[model samples]
Target: MKVCYLISAVSSDNTGRGGHYESLKILAESIYENGLDVEIVSLGDIFPPTFGNTSVKVRFIQFKKSDSLIQYIKKVADEIYDISPNVIHSFDNKSYFFARLANVKIKCKLVLTKPGGPNPKLFFPRCNDLIVFSQENFAFFKSRSRYKDVNVHYLPNRAKKILCDDLRIREIKELYDISGKVILRIARICDSYKESFIQLINLVNGLNDQGFSCTAVIIGFIQDQHVYDEIIALDCKYLRVVTEERYTKNASALIDLCDYFLGTGRGVFEAALLNKLVFTTISSSRYPVIIDEDNIDELQHNNFSPRSILKNRTEASSKEFLSSVIQILSDEIKLNEKRKYILSVAKQRFDISSVMDSYMEIYLNCFPFKRNLIFDIILNSLVVLKVYALLKLSKNKKAKA
Candidate 1:
């Protein structure tokens, strides 16, 4: 059966920055290698780097600035109709929305994979199958009455073991002036993570001030320039911020140069595959929790994200946070044991071959089913209205403040 993977964009560049983009590339490549006819339909411009090296064909749906939402979706629908794919699988909310509206005309099997934590503002369109990367997300959707009839599957993110040339590693270290005990983070520089970034910079500087040799290197795309500027303005000597333009290659290689990783999602799992100790924190968290054998299962349930612990989150003093980290860092035997256990878990949980098999099973079973177009559209419209109301309320509160 032909599969059309739909996405908002192919990549920011050849070396993709975000988790969903990377995961799409990996999954698409695997599907192509299995000899199934696989094609990618992108709503945004496809960068040359991402498609140049791949065998799978990519179609870009150009959007005119003057076009209304209906017109844009019609363009997407027309493209899918021409392709006549057996299944149209979309990633991200925007693409999923367009896929749902477009499929009303085409009536093909639709599949959506939630790339991140559930967003209250976004609606999950009724589809043949819905896949979530974390167990927490699975439970969240399953408990919702709206999703009771939908098939929800919990599939952990997958990562291939990364290997880098020694020369490249040495060159990167020298270029960044990285030395001492390195703390690395790979995530988007956005408002949601602004506080966490500040706390991390201060934590690293505190370690250095206390005579501990340490430095932190944060690498990611600049989604929020204001947040990125704030982080840069801090000017901490112990911290280095690498934007997307500078660090374009597979970031997992950088994990090899670090003693610890402070981030979440696929990066955490990738670091674990590399046997690097991983630590994560919730939004506004004063302390970061190390993902060790004791809490690996819990963290994995939330996709190794800060959201996993958000509900029970309590702020600790900076001193307390530093003390806990220092204790863990000082214990070499325990750190080594933790690394070994996390590596074993990563191998068992995130093997790409096994993940591909699961995906294939889902795709094969996703047969065309009857859907109530009018009811689904009305329900989705209500969800959108609710999100708008919430946003307006938030804006009013901010204005009052």
Candidate 2:
């Protein structure tokens, strides 16, 4: 069976860095390797080089600013019809919207993989199947009355073992002048993470003040220029921010070089697969929780994010969190044990091979193609208006601030 993967380059910037792109790349490559026909349909200017040397076909349908939404949808629908895929899987909400509307012309099974957190202003389109990465999201969707007839799959973000070249690792270390114990953070440098970035800098300073030689390296795409500038302006000798425009090396390679990983979402699993001690925190978290034998199950349930656990668990304060990390770093035996356990758990839970198998099953299962053109048009109109209003409100609030 042929599968066409839909990605929205406009929404994601086609930067080749975010979790959605990474996950799609891994899944698509695996599907192609399994001898099934796979094609990636990008609705923007150009696809990122994340595909690397893979032979999978990538078709770019550039959406011009002058084109109306309906025109773009028709254009995409024509392309998908030409590909004649049995299953069209979309990664982002925008792509899913287009695919849902386009499917009216071409009646094919549709799948949507919800990548980010829930949006209050947006509404999900009905599809043959839906996949969510976090357990909290999966449970919430599964219990929803609207999705009683939909097939909701709970699949966590996956990471495969990546082998980093020794030469490349040495070059990255020399370029960053990394020394002593390294705490690495990989995320998008946006307004949501501004407070977390500041907290991380302070934590590094505290670690050094406590007589531990430590350096913190942050590698990420710069989404908000103001936030990125604010983070860069902070005077911290122990901190280094590697913007995406500057660093082009594989992120997993950096994880392999780090002694501890500091961040949340898919990066937690990526770092764990590399045997790095993973510490997870949400955007609003004052302190991070270390993932070890005792808390791995709980954390994994929430996709290693403390957002769901904050209400029930009393988290450590800034000082207490730093002390805990320092204590772990100082004890070699404890740190080694934690690393081994994390690696084992990562292999068992996030192995890409198993994830691929699950996806294959979903793709092969036949699901009826159903659509209500009138209801869909009304639903899409309301969703677009709500999104527009939300954006306007956000801009007003930012201007007032």
Candidate 3:
């Protein structure tokens, strides 16, 4: 089936961590791999690298970000009329809101993928189906009865494959000047959350007080000018901030040396895939999270209370950061076991193949008009198995030869 995928922006040159361009890339590639007709329409200067390389068509309808809903819809409608797709999948709430507002009787099946946000319980104009990163959030949304007839579905946020080539692990070790046992935090320097930064600073102070000799490497961009200032003030040797090119290479490299990732982060699953420990709290329902935490440090409210910008996180105050840090430090085997569990779970549920199946099922459900017979399903399944076997054998033969 031919599908039209629309997103906010896919700028490879300036892909902020918050932007879901990588996820969009994976989805687009999978659609083409499955032998489906696909066209991508997005705002901004971003173009898919393989746009002309693939059979799938990629089109750009350049529109300003500030365009109002009516104006935006008119712009999209003009193009939609020209290249009618079987379905239109909107990437996030902003794009979904605009698309739904634009298309009332929605000629094509409308689908949306929600990848969590600073604002939880986002109120968006209804679509055919709501694809969430968490089943828990989906159930919560379903219970609220926002849209009576709309379908809500859950799919795990798939891990990204960094375009990193093999390098001597030791080269990375010396480049970061890392000690192999360092702690890593790969969050963007600038973020939309005040609590996220506040909590991180508290955690660092907590870890230091306990005399944990672990280093912290700050990967990703510094979005906030003030936060950048705060980080500079620390002047901590172990915790250094690097930007752009260094940031990209260091991430793939740091994955090897880091024993654990400890932050409220966007890179937990990425860490898990690279075989590192990821530790963070289960964010309050107020915040959106896609990747389920293997261990959640329940928030201790009183401990977070402060009269001013500097908060007091003492044991007497409810034991928020200190207790969880201590608990994590005390249990080495626990973190190791959690790492093992993450790898096992990822291999089963969040791999590219399984994630592609989730998208296909959603596609089939959203557009029942396109019917494939039972025989078609059987034939496709057999072909998939044959392809898998041939690839496996090719690898085996190459190793032997």
Q: Write the per-residue lDDT of candidate 3 for residues 96-137, one digit (tens) a residue.
A: 543443454446677887664322443344555877665445
Clashing pairs in 2: none
Ranking of all candidate structures by their lDDT, best first: 2, 1, 3
Q: 275-368, model 2: which lDDT tens digit per residue?
A: 8888776546655667777667666666765353644566666667678787888999988988888888888888777777789889888484
Residue range 233-268, candidate 1, lDDT tens digits? 888988888775545445556677788988678777
lDDT of candidates 1 onward, in order: 0.72, 0.73, 0.54
lDDT for predicted candidate 2 compared with the true structure = 0.73
TM-score of each: 0.83, 0.87, 0.66
Candidate 3: what lDDT? 0.54
Better of 2 and 3 by lDDT: 2
Sorting all predicted structures by TM-score, with the top scorer first, yields: 2, 1, 3
Best by lDDT: 2
